[model samples]
Target: MYLSDKVLIVEGKTDKRRIEEVLVEPVQIICTFGTMGVSKLDEILEQLDGSEIYILSDADKEGRKIRKWFKKHLSESTHIYIDPKFGEVGRCPRDYLANLLMRHGFYVDTSLIMKGKFYDERAVGDTGYIQSYSL
Candidate 1:
């Protein structure tokens, strides 16, 4: 199973959205939010059908617990942790998962889509350029 053909399993909708936003290629994203149990794990694994898998979750204690449980169940899947830096407001997870994957040699960056916003407050502070004032 190749990484490109694999599916990424996340913890919630926000994680799914963020992963989609950062990934260079289109891959399936699965969410397992609020459904943490043995049955749910079995169901998800069955749906995966032994395909290559990557697990990206928060870098907190809860995330660690989830990872442990997933590892115990889906021992064959490839799991990776997305650092907390990718999270939004320290609550909603961000798209840093994709970036971390790219850092590894498994995934490739195709379209090079750059999501998120960039602010340039310096433009507003350029008094000389705006007011035509010379030093």
Candidate 2:
């Protein structure tokens, strides 16, 4: 596959699949499977140089571990957090992911931007979408 300037690091295939549904631009998404290890890091490092990296994992213990590992090795990478309520990236509402990605300057499918029942209406600002539940 062609390499993309932007790379998204996710926890598993399910998470990768969810993000793929809304992506409008080319982004290489890599799955960590679960907890990160030296071997996995070695594989991921090859594609990281000169690319914009975005770390997005679940809101759970294993996810935090992976995030911490990435932070230590890839401090320059941007971290994208999903609200604890969503639990897992794969489980997060599509609209929520769409808005979050948009705020991060990533192109997403506009059709996935409709309001979700869990969104706080008050948070909708000039962007015309939920600001973000992510940190």
Candidate 3:
């Protein structure tokens, strides 16, 4: 129910903002800005008091790279990846992300769009959010 101890780590401001908009609990979000600098990430991780960490990045190659990076450095932290299946319908990380949360039983607002709305012709374009990442 309450995600007071669970933190969602993303890759940028837009991802963080979009995720916060849909979550019911107070989920702390951290952005790595393409590649998370070791010192910066270390500082952020140090501040965390053993909270569960969920990594939600774009369902693309770059996202996998970032996830891999985190896995190597934060192996002890509980980590879960946003499902890539949702990305097939809508490339916006938010769409797949919202669905991922829904699958995990997290309450997310779907009033503006219903289930499977991602398959709508209007929602077919890619967000290009993953292109900016180098990995």
Per-residue lDDT of 91 in model 2? 93
lDDT of candidate 2 over 1-135, digit per residue (tens) = 534589999999999999999787778999999979988898999977788899999999999999999999889999998899999999988889987877676777766777654334544679876443221
**What C-alpha lDDT, on a 0 to 100 scale, does residue 90 get in candidate 2?**
98
Each candidate: what lDDT?
0.57, 0.83, 0.61
Give the TM-scores of the predictions, in the order they appear.
Answer: 0.64, 0.83, 0.64
For residue 120, give model 2's deviation from the true position in Å. Answer: 11
Using lDDT as the measure, name the better of candidate 1 and candidate 2.
Answer: 2
Leading candidate by TM-score: 2
lDDT of 1 by residue, 22-131 (tens): 55555677777835788888778777865678776676666777778888877777777554664421243233343355544233232331343321223223552211
**Model 3: number of clashes?**
0
| Residue 103, candidate 3: alpha-carbon lDDT | 52
Find the candidate with the highest lDDT and give its number. 2
> Which runs of model 3 end up more than 4 angstroms from their true locations?
1-3, 78-96, 110-113, 117-135
